[model samples]
Target chain A: MDISGADLVRAAAFIGAGIAMGLGAIGPGVGEGFVGGKACEAIGRNPDEAGLLTRTMLVAQAVAESTGIYSLVVALLLIFVV
Target chain B: MDMVFDTVSIVKAGQFLGAGISIGFGAIGAAFGEGLVGGFANCSIGRRIGMASPYTRTMLIGQAVAETSGIFALMVSVLLVFGDFSANGVCAWTATLSAGICMGLGALGSGVGAGYPALEAIWGAARQPAVGGQMTTTMLIGQAVCQTPAIFSLVIAFMLMFRNCVGLDVWPYGASLLGAGIAMGFGAIGSGWGGGQAGGAACEGAARQPHLRGPLTTLMLVGQAVAQTPAIFALLVAIMLISIGPTEGTILTSAAVLGAGISVGFGAIGSGMGNGITAEGACNAISRESSTTKDMLTFMLVGQAVGQTPVIFSLVVALMLMFITFNIPATLVGFCALLAAGISMGLGAIGSGWGNGATGAAACKAVAMEPTQRPVILTLMLVGQAVAQTPAIFALLVAFILMFGNYTGPVTLPAAMALLAAGISMGFGAIGPGIGNGITAAAACEAVGNRPEERGLYMRTMLVAQAVAQSTAIYALVIAFVLIFVV
Candidate 1:
């Protein structure tokens, strides 16, 4: 029932780490989805430029995914390292 | 070790719970926000307006804003669970309330703030489908501005849950929290309203003449971004308030707040005046030669971006206030530094604004006289305005170091004087380059218009000359940095 101050703080930090990772994922996920959808549409419209569209989409999606990855790392750290 | 484990576990659990709540709520908010924008994009309005592409992009951005709150909440939750919140002496209630207030209010502003621009972009696209590309740029710039408030809120929330510098027990924790919130709140309002106005104007312009859409949109976005710079700075200041803890007296704390307000407020003035002038120039150019709208718009926006640098510098100053502590011996020196930095930014604003405005005006006139010489004229204008930006950049660098970098005490009066001199140099240094660059741009524009055949030679010569003109500003910057950091 009773808890030590140190334990409480540690627990708080763990939760914080999780929060950083979890919430961070939302932006990139949506951003990547948008890019992917747009790329697909572009490819469909101009199959000849499929390569170009795919490349651009991939590049953009990668950028979009960065934050999500950051979130993931933070989450992992919280669970294991932190 | 056992005791440590026990303490850490409790905190970790709280952290997890907080993180869950933050991200969960943020996700919900983001989803709803995106859905609204997406729905609009896919709805009859979007179809009628012909902004199907931009509409989708806006929806995604809106979702990003909505999701931030959840992240803030989640971060708070995790901090609660894992972090040593107790050692820092942050009352659990304080931490909780701060987190809640930050996420709740922050998310509210971000959601609405981001949405406004999307709506405007949609409307603009609908009215002038031909200028969709330009409209999209304007929309993004405006949206970025609108996001400032939310960003500010996020920064504050993060500080509360993670940094908690207030544990230093320097100032009343409550005041610090309230102050941080207020700083962010006001910043959001300013950026949101300013960006919205600019976006609205761009939309209206695009609708009126589809041919002029490209240049007009670029002009609007640049203007909006410049306008948003101060708000960004304000947010930075709010972050500082929470992270720096507090000063001894109420007066000093209030002074810090007032200084931040002034910095942002003055920054707004510069952005407003500069954006107005640039926009007007763009409008006139678009009217004269609609076909070359794209090049003209790009040049105008680039010019405005240069013009916005001074305001950005002020924001940097505000951020410094949060981290750098001023003692009695250093109080006067620090105050002067802050004031001088602010004034420097303001002065830099005047130079860049006028310089860029003149260039914009010249570009417009040239395009009017010889529409075929658009490329050459645009190139000249951009080069000139870029040169004009040097002094402002110099001031910014000086201000940044004075605020953030470690400084030796003003041991001797001469040393203190050197600081003051450096500040003065930065302020005055901006004027010459700004005015000179403008004149050169105007000349280049006229020359291109007069002899289109000589456009290539004229542009090359103009760029070379502009680079030479920028040298003096660079010198001033080097000198200022030396005085502040090296000396």
Candidate 2:
């Protein structure tokens, strides 16, 4: 069967969208992991400062996750909007 | 009725199916990765230390963040698979592939990279138990660098699949695809290796001297982040290629892509090496004298950040290449822009790296001699480093102009020369600041180490002095930007 221009274009769009969402998540995911890992380590070492460590970890992780969220938005827009 | 149903059915189904598959798989992968790391970190810590570890929850929470991308991908895929959406050919493929790579690789990096730093931090804590604050900071910074590749991948994937600014035909699609892959792959390599090295150094420092943990950790993070900047820049450029496309009117797109890749790759090398050195120095300082750790760490970080400025600038130039459209008469503009930006950053990196290193060493020495004046010493060190950063910033500003500004009208040779001069000015201008700031930081470190009680006053003074030193560099950037954009 002959592939029309439209089909190819449609296919490209789908692939691109998938890539953006997939790749964007990597940084935040990894970042959060590190933050979590450190927090755990800290808490274990000094249970008294658990509150501070947890707070800092959460704040930093949130910042790291921002980019991932941006990527996700883009992916959804691609899949649903155009 | 049958014809209409047939016409819409296939496209709608395909869209929905594709979205669902993409997000569902992405989420699953991320979740699985986070779960494994979180569980491992918690269990390992529990067994090694004790059952009542507050860190267990925090570790899981951090791990959960890493899972966000997976969740995001899942949501997008579900939306695409289930929803009715308009389809653009290039946009669809770019999006899917970009997302897939981002989440899949991101999960892998975050899981492993985060775990490595966490393990180090735990060991540090176990040893000192007092300097936990400093150890955590250092670990976070290293982890952030490790996460760079993942972030870069995600940015590109998202832009390709979701943003779809450049119609497929605009670029040599094959090159773009290859570029995207290279960007993420190289980025991961740089961050992963760099972070590990820096984190290890920080952990060792914390373990050796619990009191000096804060400063030592800060130095480690700064150095690592600087080292990772180049890789991040490359990723940004690759993403820009999709949106900016190659313009026939100006520089060839191929050159831009190649240049961008080279700049970031090279930048990564310098940053990594520089960071490693800084970390070593900080570690040594901490071991010798824990009391003066904070001052020494601050000085080291400031210097390292300055050293990495060139790489950051290079990334900005690459980004400009990918996004900016310039209408200039000369064919050499694109080549010059790319070359100048790359070379500028490369050269600037050398000066800042050495300068910061010297400053860090000095601070270390000063702190070792006089631990009481730590605060004053740190303030001075930061000022010196800030000044040292001027040249790199200048290079970045000039490169920005060449890449982004529109120079269309017929201008005299003098004007062209002026524009070129602008770049040169910033490049050289950075030298004074670099050396000046380094000296200032050294002195401040010494002061703080001698009179810790006067830390507040000394820090304020150093900040003011550094700001003044940075003015010249800021001026150079403004001028270059103006030359490129305004005149």
Candidate 3:
């Protein structure tokens, strides 16, 4: 039952890392899918805009994915540094 | 086993945990609901400068009703913090802690759900001032139904707090009490939120078609009742767990009992919310196409039935866990595996159920737009729903493997941790993909409905997008497998 301060800190950091990535992934996962869905709809309406729409969709997804990336970075930091 | 725990100390600790959990979780729903009501009331006032007084009054009443569940949570928390516990034992400690959890989680759904109706009611009032009074009545009725799940939680919490647990074996009974609380708490969340969504949609519908107010109300009631089915299942499970008297104090039995609660509790959440979303879509569709109210109702029922499949799977797993006994090591590894199995199944079902509901909602609106394409739309919706369910199916597979697997290796701490981590990884990993794929399917359904001639093109697009969305679930599955086998 004996535990040091480092042990407690390490345990908290691990849990925090898990939570950070888990919650963070949710927003981007849903957001990117939404962006892709809209692009599909637009492309369906006019095949002429398919290339441009696909490019735009990629950009939107990348932007949406930023937060998830940030979360991953934070998680890594928590695991490695914190 | 080395530590000594006195009755007073344990009781005090339980009370503190209970009070904190009760207020913390309970405040979430009420605050969300009240804030929504205020926001919408302001919007309504701005829209209808003349009817500001009536709208304000309606907003206040709605906020008041939504606050009831939060108040209930607060009361339970206060009682836990200050009330004297005459009953001392393991039961006293578990009961107090469980009661806090039950009240807190229970209030969360009702509070948020209650707000939806109020906000919509105000918005409706602004749109159709002529039927403002009728809309207010509808909002109240909807909010009342939304509170039923919360009341169920409150009852369970009260029972847990006051129950006689004298001479009961600590392990099984304590775990059972805790499970009962978890089951009731998480179970109420979805039903409350879903019921509110349906109520809000109905209020908006009433404003759209004032003449059909009675029928709209009827539809809302039916939808709300269907949406509450998961919560009802949870209540049944909670009651069953609560009624289980002192059993043999085995760690294995304790794990199974707790697993049952976790399974049904988390399992009920998605189905309840999914059913509500389907009902919301149906209400909106009927309002748009008054001529097709009959068709819309039938479609909504079918969609909701399909949407409940994930919860049904969860219920089956829970029942099995509760009733069936399996021979395994009574060690921590075995306990973790059994518990993780429930966790995997319960969390896995959430995303699929929610996604299916979204797809159903889209299909419902599409059906209203193109009644001629009803069969086609239904087929597409089902396909989307089925695809969305892959993550749940994967979760179920992982759960089955974990529960039934024969391990010849040493029952070490890493093995236990890996088993738990596998479940955690899969359970959460499935959520995003399920919802993401559903979003893709929903868009596809709408697109096809708008352009029936291009059904094939839309279908292809939907499948492609869904496949991409599902990749994340696949990755999670891989991680889970690696944890189970490699780690």
Candidate 4:
């Protein structure tokens, strides 16, 4: 059975999209976890700083999450544009 | 679709794909390692303005050394892309793809692992400018040891690229070749990372106690050596798989052979990393209190041994799959079962092995902190490690059942898929629980060490947490059973 070039390219693009999302998520996941853990430790040590720590943690996590968002964009491009 | 090549399109496609994969994965580790060096070097330089020149030199040297495996991968990719393959057949196609996979994955671990030591060495040198020379030496040694797995991967990649694969049966032989690549590539990752961790810890320890640099280096070497055992096992399996020249029996046999490679390759990752963590803890412990180096070494070895169990189980399963010839029909169901069994065992081992290492590391630290609580710490660690091992044991049982169970059903696609799903379910299910249990164990050990009087309370609390964590693994096992039996 012979596969057309268009068909093969399409299949490859889909696979690439999936792989991009999968590998891309790993860094953000790890980064966010570290941020949250440190924040919790800080809060525990100084309960008066709980509000500040939580706000800082969320901001750090959001920044870390940017990479994951970029991965998603790339994946979308692969799926739709490519 | 723009322009289609005539006769050699398939081989050309394979070559191009292989090249892309080789460089793509190769880039990840080296870039990460260099970044790590750069980041830490900047931090060190910031602390001491007078040390900027030396720190920069160390960073450059360390980054260059970490780039070695990446360079090896690039060489293979260049060769794959520009090399002639017009006269080759399907065998060459498989060979190129396998070679790419081997080099790409092999470069990953060593690059990241090597970075740890370099960064630590630079950081250490900033603190203790007097022992800068010795710290640099230790860093180089650790980074070099970490690269062993990558070197093994390079050797296998070279073998795959240049070997005479013209006369072999294309289909079954192709799977075996691919399996060889997967085994060597995945196997190298954990060992490289683990060895680097041990090396980095040693450098840090040496910086703290320049007087004990000799003992620190000795412990680092031993730890790195132990951490490398899993990668060695992977190399052995990959070599054996590569040597299996002809496809003998049927498609089922091919599946089993390929499954064997998958089992051994993925299984080694967790074990290598676990041993590395244990070694890192041991190095730090010795640095803190040089008096207990002998006892700490023994404890580290023991912890590493327990962590090695999951990989050993994988090895056994892999060996059995490779050697044993089942006289079953060449049905899709049989093929799925064989392949799924390997997947279940390999993936299941990862979390358990890593979890055991975490427990061991904690226990090692606790022992160093309170020598008097040695008996309680050891017992608690063993118990926690054992609990962590349960998910892997469950996975092994499921793998065995999948491999040896009778399949008297019709050759339906659903049945084959169900078997495959069962493996996936159990394999992925076991990972989180194993790690979670290990975390619980580590915390329990730390608590027990801090207050030896409350050992019983901590032990009980640890067991409860572990049991809760283990529930998810049980659910996965049950679902896997349902998939295999009911579905």
Give each candidate's fraction of reference contacts reproduced: 0.00, 0.00, 0.24, 0.00
Tell me the spans in candidate 4 whose CA falls farther than 4 Å from its real position: A1-82, B1-7, B86-88
- Ranked by TM-score from best down, the candidates are 3, 4, 2, 1
On residues B184-223, what C-alpha lDDT tens digit does candidate 3 reach at each position?
9999999999999999999999988988788778888988
Report the Cα lDDT for candidate 2: 0.51
**Model 1 residue B429 lDDT?**
52
Among all windows of ten consecutive residues in candidate 4 chain B, which has the lowest summed lDDT?
B460-469
lDDT of 2 by residue, B73-153 (tens): 565555555544335543344345444444444334333444445555655555555655555665666556556555555
Best by lDDT: 3
Best-matching candidate per TM-score: 3
Q: Per-residue lDDT tens digits of candidate 4, residues B337-452?
A: 88888888888888888888888988888888788888898999999999989978988998899888889877666567667767776776677667767776876776665667
Off by over 4 Å in 1: A1-82, B1-271, B293-299, B324-331, B364-375, B404-418, B456-487
Higher-scoring candidate on DockQ, 1 or 4:
4
The best candidate by DockQ is 3
Error of 3 at B70 (Å): 1.0
Chain B TM-score, one value per candidate, order as shown: 0.47, 0.48, 0.97, 0.97
lDDT of 1 by residue, B1-487 (tens): 4554443344344445444544444444445545555565666254665444556665565446545544554555555545565444433334444444445444443444455456555555665566555655555655565555556666666666655443343234444554454445434443444444455455546656766656666666666666556556656666666665463554335434444544443443444345445555665556555765666666566656766665666565654554445542344445455555544454444455555656666666677668866667777777766765665666666655554544445444334434554555455555555555555565566556655665655555455445544544554554455445543
